[model samples]
Target: MTRLLEILISLAIVAVLFTVVGFILPSSRHLEHSVETNRKMPIVFDTLNSVRRFKDWNPSVAGDPNIKLNLSGPESGVGAKISWDSEEKALGQGSWTISKSEPGKLIAYAIEDVDRGHDKSSEFTFTPTGKGGRNIQITQAYDVNYGMNLLGRYSGLYVTSNIGEKMKLGLASLSNMLATIPNLDYTVLGKDDPALAPKLADRAGENLLVLNAAVPLNQITIQTQMKTNIEWIKKNIAANGLEAVGPVRIITNEYGSSIYSFDVAQQVRKAGTDATVKLEGLKLANNVELLYNEPGKTAVVAFKGHMSNLQNVRDALRAWAMTRGYETIDRPYEAWKNGIDPGFAPGQEGEYDVVWAIK
Candidate 1:
């Protein structure tokens, strides 16, 4: 009887120790990882704000090649969500929804994982660093609430080795992906009006009268050359019984500091016919050529400025396309919206739809 009493006493002591240790453990977990890059704030913020490019930079996707992803809600900012299903036991099924977004500042996501059940959240905070804020530091933080779940509190002990490590890997992958995008800031293109933002568009195939010109980069010289080319295009349109159907397009070949070489083109159609009908017989000048541009996808942005600033706009447009994983397939061109009448004089404003063909 004495031995039996001793065994019961030992069991009571063990239960007490287990309960005390469980209650003593913290009921919450917080983990953070940070990475710094020279990439601008806009680029980093935009990347985190949207889930469209999530697979590209997400380290978890690389672990499971057959993982299926479904995206819902708006395209970006708050309300965007991405859910994943994987055959791998570690991944199982989970969903991430954007809970909050502050432009150039912070992005927070509500994370749900079926395998790991706990109220979890993750956020990315941006801070400008380096001299003159040329570089940005991105901090990815994670939080989980265990509450009264002792089992969850025990799991929290390994959170650093598991969730913490994933955050580190993710941040590194994000920095690498940011490096692939062009560094030029495209947001400036739409500073005054949102409509001027770079957008995906389609260009219809059309017959064009193209005149190639190479002249000194002087504003007066370039204007004179454009005038001569436009006159030739007009005469060809008249001689061939065709009508000018659209604004003039200038396809930039090269814009060197000393010389500017470009192709001056005008879309044309047979007289009294829509642009859909192909011109069968057209007279072309010796210096001009007839070329057909095929219909394709393009990134377009509107600009009202002098011609000298067009290069920067083009670069910005290309950068925007690159951020979306689009590849430039053809040389960029400009559709002069107000016609080519405005001479290339200083302070002369010209309206144009800058275009870059992409796929």
Candidate 2:
């Protein structure tokens, strides 16, 4: 009877200890991790603002290749969401929705997990660091409320090994991804105006009369060559029973210090049918060829500047495309908004739609 009584007292004491410790534990948990990168603010912010590229840099995705993911809501900023289902017990099922976005500053997400319950959030804040603020320091923070749940408070003890470790891996992955993108500042092309930012667009396939030429890097020389090419194209268009359908396009093949090599192209179509004529039967002039530009995606930007500046704008467009994880597939080109004659006039400032084919 004495032995039985001692055993009962020891059991009661152990239960009391567990309860006391559970009550003493905090009901809330916060985890933070940071990483630094030389990438620009916009590049880092854009990556986190949209769930479109979530699978690319997310460590969790890499850990579970079989995880299925779905994207919903807007493509970027607040309301963008990504949901995932994984066979792995650790991942289970969950969704992350962008709850707040401050361009170049911060992005916050509301996280939901079947096993973790609710009232969980994560955020990424950006701060300019290093010389001339060229480098960026990114801090990721996670917060969870356990309320009165003792089990959850105890689970918080492992949060560092679980959630904290993931954040560090994720930020490292993000830095590596950013390294692949071009570091050029695209805003220089638009003079810092968001309205003039480079944008992705679709280009329909079209039949073009193309004339390739190499000319001395002089405005007058370039203009003369283009004019000669356009006249030849006009004659061919008339003979082929086709009409010029769009402004002249200049595809830059090479822009050397002393020489410029380019293709002068014009879209053409049958007058009433709006369809291009077959190239096989068409009569061609010297140095001119019929081409069918295949339909594809492109990065485009509007620029009002001299022809000499077009090359710089093309570079900027390419940088912008790279930052968005796009690959360039063809040479850059420009559609002259103003007629070729006036666009090449001395001291003339012309408007053009600079385009770079990308995939």
Candidate 3:
């Protein structure tokens, strides 16, 4: 009994000395992990911007099902924040808010403890890599100050192994997420105009339930007509007790200053004859008709603000396609992944992905 007691005392003293020594260690630590992805910077930026998808790839949320999580503000970019609380000690409780956003370049976040205020800093930087900016170098980093707490300071020893491993895992998940995305690149025309960047992507055909609208080959009211078609599609889909599966797509073959033709449609799950949303003055093209986006090469660009400004982007895309060997197989289309809000003033920003099918 006496020998056991001595051994226990010695062990306790050793722990005390270890913690005491930890006090002299640096209280601040910075770690970074990087991964190369074949996806373009915009897709990587978009993926990281969407915090709603974090539960799928984030290491912290990977295993925990009981965490109390509250997501507030915008789902992506500035003002986005996610607070999570857990009974697990390693998980603890805290909130992270995007503090700064420089689109396509960097995104920074500040972490705050639920009870103690400011906690740490984390960020992701996207650097263009590979040929013609077709690839991206994704760097995720964290800067943490352990303070004077011995246990906290001692935790610094594991930052490289623990936090770094998590970053690596997260990056791997991100790479996998982007792997199947069509190979795309960009030729930035101006820093002030991301929409005019002349981007390109490789896309595969998808099953769609679209509402087709045929209009005059040359009409200045195309934007207005586009919205009209969207409203019809939405109302009819809701009328059918169904929901659109994805973004609204515009289909067309002819477009010029003097001539234009188009089809405005919404993507939907493919189903049999009975499953259809019939819109007034429009046909629910129940067939998987013009869904093929050639086996490779498509033109894409950022479209925002007034849909009218999209004309400039389309012109730029045509110029880009002409410069390359690509030929336009269809009319320009906008994928409205996020709902369209046509009320924004000029120069104000929004998210709308435009694709032009080419063979």
Candidate 4:
């Protein structure tokens, strides 16, 4: 009787010890799953990188149809930021910052949740494969101090799977959506070296006519023309809910009814504000050109202020072209800063686009 009782008591103590050890010992709860989806890498990466676009793929956006999102920095490139306040634990108060981005290739970001632990980072890679398709691979990693490591692991896995699955689906859907839109080849002007323009002209047996579209020309009474263009631009700006900059000068090559010059920049300023458009860190100076160099096509449209948003302008233009059934044949031209300081008056950036028949 004594031995039996001792044995039972010893077993009970051993069981308790084992139970305690199991609870205290560090363990990880992790889960990860992936699905292959079809989507262009650029579109996927761009959508993920921009908070404005993230809504299309975020599965955690629930119960807060009106969550306020504050945007800072550029719209889509590196150094973009989005701060959001959400009630959902999966997307509690946090901001997504672009840590690194390689256009159409890879993007990595860090998620800082004010309510959740410290920080978590995720990386997404886009790989092009055979059969005219692209595969997006997403990997999420979590790191935390010992005790919370378990929770971190589980959260990371769940969030990653959930978000990754949505991303895949969104990307797939986006691909389908984009496919429905006709694949139009954007007009990118072949690089005609400023240095080679003379040579090309010589070979073509033509005058060495350099088209300068930057500054306003000394000739031409363009007050009415400028007003007309500015008014047109203002309407477009309002339509897109973007601010307007100018009815600024436009470039036109003309001397008494015979077009000799192609500088449209001066044409815009004649009737509009004198201050030039401002852009910081724009490496490439450009000469703006019209899509169809035809007669009576002079017009101006205000591209919203974010210089980084030139793509939006391009995308908008592409859509416009599609609607008009016009084919773009030349690379879009731009004027390097018209020697204007953007700081003088913010939101005054505008462009004057003009075209003339080549006789």
Kindly list the per-residue Cα lDDT of model 4 for residues 1-359, writing each as its tens digit.
Answer: 99999999999998888667645644443223333434445444545556554544444344478776777777666677778887765567777777888876767766676423454555556665546564555433333222444444334445445545655565554454444333422222112333211011111111111224322332232333333444554443344333423223333333233322333332211123332332122121222221212222211123324333343444444433322223344334233234223312356653322221111
lDDT, candidate 1, 26-87, per-residue tens: 89989889999898777888888888778887665557889999999987899999899999
Top candidate, metric lDDT: 1
Give the lDDT of residue 330 in candidate 3: 56
Quote each prediction's TM-score.
0.82, 0.83, 0.51, 0.42
lDDT of 1: 0.86
Error of 2 at 154 (Å): 2.6
What is the overall TM-score of model 2 with all chains considered together? 0.83
TM-score of 4: 0.42
Residue by residue across 102-157, what tens digits does model 3's lDDT show? 98889898877522212688899998888887678988988887677677777787
The TM-score leader among the candidates is 2
Q: Over 4 Å off in model 2, which ranges?
A: 1-16, 114-117, 187-197, 214-225, 254-261, 276-280, 294-297, 321-328, 341-346
lDDT of each: 0.86, 0.84, 0.66, 0.42
Between candidates 1 and 2, the lDDT winner: 1
